[model samples]
Target: MTDQVEERVLSIFREKFHKPEVTIDSSFAELGIDSLDTIEALFEIEEEFGISIPDDAARSLNTFREVVAGVEKLLAEQRIANPPAAAGPDAAEEGR
Candidate 1:
């Protein structure tokens, strides 16, 4: 999951910054990403992943790896918050 997320995110970084060499270990500073770039990238990420990243987490992320980890954490939290309901006659009756 992390690997897939990392690849998607790295793609976003590459497209946003026009840098084809962006890697998971690349620091934002090393990539010459500024505050505005970070905000834009975060917005793009949220839109792409359907998850909201908190300000603290966003601010704390310095590398691509951290961004991937943060996205994974948010996805886990989303799953916990909205787990799938059991499917059976009882669930159908409850819905009715």
Candidate 2:
């Protein structure tokens, strides 16, 4: 999951900032990303992942790796809050 999210994040960085060389270790300062760009990128990420990132966490994400970790954490929390329902045989047995 982390790997997938990391890939998505890298893609976002490349598309949003027009920087193909961006990596997980790259900081916002290093990429010449400003506050507005960060906000725009966050919006894109939220839309892509269907998750809302809090302002505090969003602002604190200085590095690409931090963003990936934040996204992963949000996804985990979302899963815990809304776990998937039983399916197939298990669901049928439960309904019996």
lDDT of 2: 0.89
- Clash pairs detected, candidate 2: none
In the range 16-61, model 1's lDDT, one tens digit per residue, is 8899999888999998998789989999999999999888878888
lDDT of each: 0.89, 0.89
Q: What's each prediction's TM-score?
A: 0.86, 0.89
* lDDT score, candidate 1, position 46: 100
lDDT (Cα, tens digit) per residue for candidate 2, span 1-96: 788999998899898778999988999998899989999999999999999999999878899999999999999898777766564455567878
Q: Which residue segments of model 1 deviate by more than 4 Å? A: 86-96
